[model samples]
Target: MTPNDTKPSAVTVRGLVKHYGETRALDGVDLEVREGTVMGVLGPNGAGKTTLVRILSTLLTPDAGHATVAGYDVVRQPRQLRRVIGLTGQYASVDEKLPGWENLYLIGRLLDLPRKEARARADELLERFSLTEAARRPARTYSGGMRRRLDLAASMIGRPAVLYLDEPTTGLDPRTRNEVWDEVKAMVGDGVTVLLTTQYMEEAEQLASELTVVDRGKVIANGAVEELKAKVGGRTLRVRPADPLQLRPLAGMLDELGITGLAATTVDTGTGSLLVPVLSDEQLTAAVGAVTARGITISSITTELPSLDEVFLSLTGHRASAPQDARPADSREEVAV
Candidate 1:
């Protein structure tokens, strides 16, 4: 069985709602994160992604609805809930004044770990996160990736059953991002249920088994990765011309082949590529042959299922990671929290 099919929900949210004055941060959002798996909450800025994380993390009281993390009510049993949940927001919240090892040890102590156990845990995490060599150096001396890893280590110091990661890999390089992804997979392997909120489609696809997409304070879509991809016309032939300006013409040419659904959805302006539904190998071969026959040069060509970005755009009329006022909503969310 898939993760969502068999495991009970580690977290459950029913009719969740939160408003910031005139702005509806969350509008009756319903969600579930299966035990020992990652539930990706995907959305753009100002879409209330942070609001949902705040409520579930017990940092903010919802205006309406009920949520339970690890069987503890967010509002009614916040202290109990806090014991089982760990949060890592978009930016690292580590103490730059402290060394890496000290940060983990301090958080461990704060969680009531015994002095010996805290020290042991700190040593273990520093080694695990590849910070052992620089454990004694102040956090401000570490690289961006190092700082992020240190922050991640700090969150796991409590061995919490459920972790809330709110856009945790927002501004990292691809290598560092992959490192974080590996760490997330390792957490699930250890049976830690994770609620990951991110606006990056690639990140959502890489880490999450299932996704809940929030837009304008509502869950517009929620399903397995493949299920969401299927909704936006699955297995599309991504045809990118040598010249971006030729995209419309390429679509027109593809439509001439009479592929039933090719005409309606063609140009993904965001990527400047045409996505033609791939129904069968024979159809794809025919389409490729036609393009070659017409002598239309292509910069790239591939047949793949719909990406999470397309699925997201099809569900909500916005790009998942478009440029925006850098984390303004997040700052406001922290204030609200």
Candidate 2:
């Protein structure tokens, strides 16, 4: 059985609070991460996600409440806590001039590994991250995805039990993002507990076993992705008409079907699509028949669960904006790790 197969909690927090002057960065935040699983902290920019991470990682002190990582108190055993946790932030921290192997080797030395052992560990990590071919090349010569893998490798030099990844793939291309996702999945397969902070719902859905949504310094919601989606308005039926002008006609047909509680929202002219909030599988079946009866062609039609974006809006009364690296109002200077 894997570490996640066990019942122990890897990280725990309760009634956490933090403030910078008048602004509250975190307030009564609470969460628990299962061992060897990924717990995603999902939120928009300026939602205290980073503040909570800083406190949990022992880089910053909370004003109140308690937190523990790897069974050690975050406040009282910070040094020991740091030893058991590794962190990778929004940007890569690798030195541009250093080769990939050197970066990992340097971190191992910093963690007090003997020279020969550090070198061996570096070689092992390079092979594990699939960077052995590029191991000797300057980090500046590597692509964005390779650089990110190198950064992740550096964080693992000390073999931390819990890893903290804060927006680890924020600016990468889709392919690169997937590459990093694969790496993260591989890490979890090796029993590394992860706490990933991200603003993108897709990222949370892709990697997290459980998620906690924070907004304006407080946790607005928490659950598995499916559970959280159910808390929103439930799944929706989305249709993309084959012909742009058919959108209106399709909506009219759907409304005219006399199906109870089936009201199609206005068509989005730009995308030639219409979204209908669905309360049951019966409504989806009725919708399909209605469109077919009208002889209207649709390029694509599907019922999808409420996305993380909708969940955020429903819980917080606002939609998530574009992804950014902005921090909460109470954010102060970076606390050294």
Candidate 3:
């Protein structure tokens, strides 16, 4: 969408809830996405990330609460919301029998674009996604990465103002994943608001201006990358010894500095290493000085911030492992709107 066409607050949700029998899929989840910015939704498996996306995209209704996408109520104005939103799920949804260009063209036509406009859009997306060289090939012949790009292109056919990408880069190589990230950046530059769901910490850090961490169907933490990391704790000092014989002295130094729970191991199989967690920068410097004074040669000393995985584990009681590849094939029962 063009910059002039973009509106602020493309998505807003409050107290959204969905249930499956006795299980609460979404427990009063609240989310907001600003216009022309990427908002990343992060969570571990069974955390209701997909359900929130589905509700906002108009695929599923909520048991309680309200949501609006692109200024239209998702429940009351489902058709209007659907028209302005594009959803690309964890799996590619392209028709294997259709050629790459044809798949995009078909979606354009489905969105009521004229034949000429549809064809032009198809070609434009084909070139934009670097699929022009293989545009005429059936989707079945395309690689996993190619199929994913085509699927993403299909969703953009109508120039959606709000896009929902649910784990869009799963199962792709690093190169292809970077390509997708580039496209997402381009979309934001062009003023399309995005809601991206993923378990990849780096992905969220790279693209999202704001992030929400969900656990057990509730938002446990939400903020910018640095802010979330700060919530987990401060920096950690890491030290690796030059000699295995220095481990004992290192432990004593760490103990003298009041840095307890110092763990030692051979990280490089041959090189001795000791990892200890200190509370502050002053403690880090004191520990290092004490070890060096004891004639211990320090191979490496560095300060490490808590990763997103560490933040998630600290906030939620579980680590953000890679999501499973399984997608429910059967349609789930609809809950109340």
Candidate 4:
């Protein structure tokens, strides 16, 4: 590969559209990913997120659109495009009967690597992914996290210029998810452009340099995480009174602060609180003052910015934890609660 081959814009899409019978999976979507940045495509279950990734990764052709991967047009230059992009779908694709090392070596050989080179790459990846200890074990015996790491290693056999990860950490525990996140960060540091599709807000917030949110086959919002959060209204004020009996007074004070719709609910076991969504930082401060003036001691008072889940709900008229089948084909299923 020449220096020009290392240049960016590894994935680009314009006016992309795809359909399944009467449902339009992608409707006039446009996206651009820089050479080395991680771009997140986020949406609820039905929100065309997978469809878009599928088109850009060359797994599926678009009905009416144009895309390019590493300067090769997806439709006209698919063979060349395949050489530069790596795609890991929602499920792991490794052969369970093969040992971890064997799986990696096989992929390397399939990529046309010399036998010696393939073995070397396999050893390197096993060590890099902390799988060297289990390198000889059948992949089916590996834990979910380990299997995911091996799957990722397989995708790198060709040293792809761009990587597409569809919900890479969907079923792993928190520790394993963080491990995968670290690997993604390392990839970005090494100058590989990544396009990630995930419903997890934390995943997007932690990994993506930019986010594009799809709803009903259209881009409902797109920007940096903070910028997207800002568009969803304002800060939220949460106050927990030391005495559960004081809830009524706290509610009244919140109402006096011009914050209507104040509601009381148990925050957790042995904790009672009132939550009111406020529109501004000023409202938060004023509400705090009024609560103090009422002689109610505040057990805790905090202001929180709207989360990505909140943004999704506000834009799509449904909570993130709602059923997937309830959403339109172009819409995303709510993020898991």
Candidate 5:
């Protein structure tokens, strides 16, 4: 189990609130990122994920609540907090006019490293991210993935204790995304704790052992990746009744079975079917037999493990509808204060 006793939170937040005008960008949010582990904050685009990252990175101050990174308060001890934390924002913040090597070197220098040490660190990271061949090329000449790697490498130049990655793989190709994932795994292995925010469901599942779902500027659900899935149900049993009229009754009957406790069965209005999430073969069998015993015919029946998309829908009462362009009011709360 990640975030187990063996590890304690390197970062902690309590009732962290931030507002952009009248909009509550973050509403009483609380979180924990265990030391040396990845805590994935998963939500739809414009779901206040970026705002949370900004506040944690000490770039923006919160309106209410408190946050600490490496035992330093974000508001009161921002300088110390900044020293122990790194941030890779949604878009690549690298200077396109500079080469990859220069970008990293500049960041290292800003961190107050000696000139030679900064140069060595920059080269080392270029090799680690497989950008050595293109290190001399300007950032604008680099590919999307390469620039992202450079941005990430720059964040790590100071060897910070905690890193905040806000949608780091948002626009990369699958291959490049996987490459970033490998680097993150390597960082965690080296005892660097990370707090990762992403809209991609697979990214959260693949990178973080612990996960939190943020929506409408609040933490809606949180647990281990498997724990959250299990909460929504690992396997969902889909049953389409031959008679639409039988849908509700069949759902009630299955719910009465208490195989998964109250509210376990949901009626899928679109297809007039009952979706009963089951944990075992026996529970699936019981629900099916109960429907048939009641003279209700099942038009189609199947069982499938719940996808993260489904989990998001179930928790938020809506599909994880992400916008491609500038976000609506809720998610684009990263206003400078």
Candidate 6:
């Protein structure tokens, strides 16, 4: 069964509303994060993605509706709720002056672990995150990736049942981002329920078992990654012309094919490439035939399912601005975490 098919939501929200004076940050939103799974909240800046995380983590109160984490009411039982949740914000929240080991150990002690146990846990996490050799060095000397891992390790001191990750990989490099993704997968394997808000579509595609896409403070779409992708009009047939001038010509040829549902969606990137939405093998075959018959030399041809970026564009009427082409996360390799 899929993650969403699991019973007993680790988090639940209903008609959650939060307003900043005349501006509504959250417009009667609702969401569910199933037990032992990652629920991705995907949106652009000012989409209220962080607001949702804040409410579920007991950092903010909704003006209307209710929310619960691990069966503890966020507003009514915040103290008890805090006991079961962990939060990692967009930026690293580590103490730069302290060594990585000391940072995590201090958190363990603050959580009331005994001195010996805190020391042991710190050692264990240092090794787990491959920071053992650098454990004694001050955090400011650590790399960006190392600092992120250290911050995550600090959050785990409590071994929270629910973890709130608010854009945890925002400014990290691809390798560092992959490391964080691996850590997230590890936590879910250990039965930690995760609620992650991110502007990276590939990040959501990589980590979330299911996604809730929010725009203007309301849920615009919710489903598994593939289910959401299917909403972008299915597989897209793409062609790169050998001659740069052939790009628009190829698009015109496809438009002249008179195929149903083909002309209106064709996109010319104005860079010797054409993207056409094709639903079936028949439509794909026809497009290829028409282009070749017109003597348009093709550099390369490919057909791919719609990406999360396309899905986001379709739902929100704008593409989520992401760094580095916004390609699929699966196309890249992860740093050994």
**TM-score of each model, paired residue for residue:** 0.82, 0.82, 0.83, 0.81, 0.79, 0.82
Tens digits of per-residue lDDT for model 6 on 1-337? 7646857889989999998787788998999889998999988777888888888888788899988889999999999888789999877899999999999999989888899999999999899888999999999999889999998988888889999998888778899999999999999999999999887888988999999999888999998898888765668777888887777667776787798666444656665568888887788888888777787678988888888888888899878867552345453312100
Best by lDDT: 6
Tens-digit lDDT string for candidate 5 (1-337): 4436477779889999888888888999999888988899877655688888888888889999998889999899998787778888767899999999999999999999999999999999999999999999999998878888998999999999999998787667778889889999999999999999877778888888888998878999998877787788658788898889888888777767766543478889997878886777677777777777887677988877778878888888767644243333344334532
Q: Best by TM-score, which number?
A: 3
Error of 4 at 47 (Å): 1.9
TM-score of model number 2:
0.82
Candidate 1, residues 1-337, lDDT tens digits: the string is: 5646888889999999998888788899999888998999887778788888888887789999999889999999988888788888787899999999899999999999999999999999999889999999999999878988998898899999999898888677878889999998998899999999887888888899999988888888888998888776657788888888888987887777786544344798889888877766677787777777888788888889877778888888886774232345344344331
Worst 10 residues of 2 by lDDT: 328-337
Candidate 2: pairs in clash: none
lDDT for position 216 in model 1: 82
* lDDT (Cα, 0-100) at 296 in candidate 6: 69
Candidate 6, position 15, lDDT: 96
In the range 1-337, model 3's lDDT, one tens digit per residue, is 4332354677889999999888898999998788988999988778899889888887888999998888899889998777788989877899999999889988998888999999999999999999999999999999888988998898899999989998898877778888889998998898899999988887888899889998878999988777898878767666777777767666665666554443332233343666666666666677677767777677887777888878878888886755333435342223321
List ranges where model 3 is wrong by over 4 Å.
Answer: 1-7, 239-252, 259-275, 281-302, 323-337
Clashing pairs in model 5, backbone N/Cα/C closer than 3 A? 46-331
Runs in model 6 lying further than 4 Å from the true structure: 1-3, 238-256, 264-275, 279-303, 324-337
For residue 3, what is the lDDT in candidate 2? 44
Instruction: Provide the lDDT at 39 for model 1.
Output: 92
**lDDT values, one for every candidate:** 0.84, 0.84, 0.81, 0.79, 0.83, 0.85
Clashing pairs in 6: none
lDDT of 2 by residue, 4-117 (tens): 446689999999999978778888899999998999987766788888888988889999999999999999999888888899987889998999988898899989999999
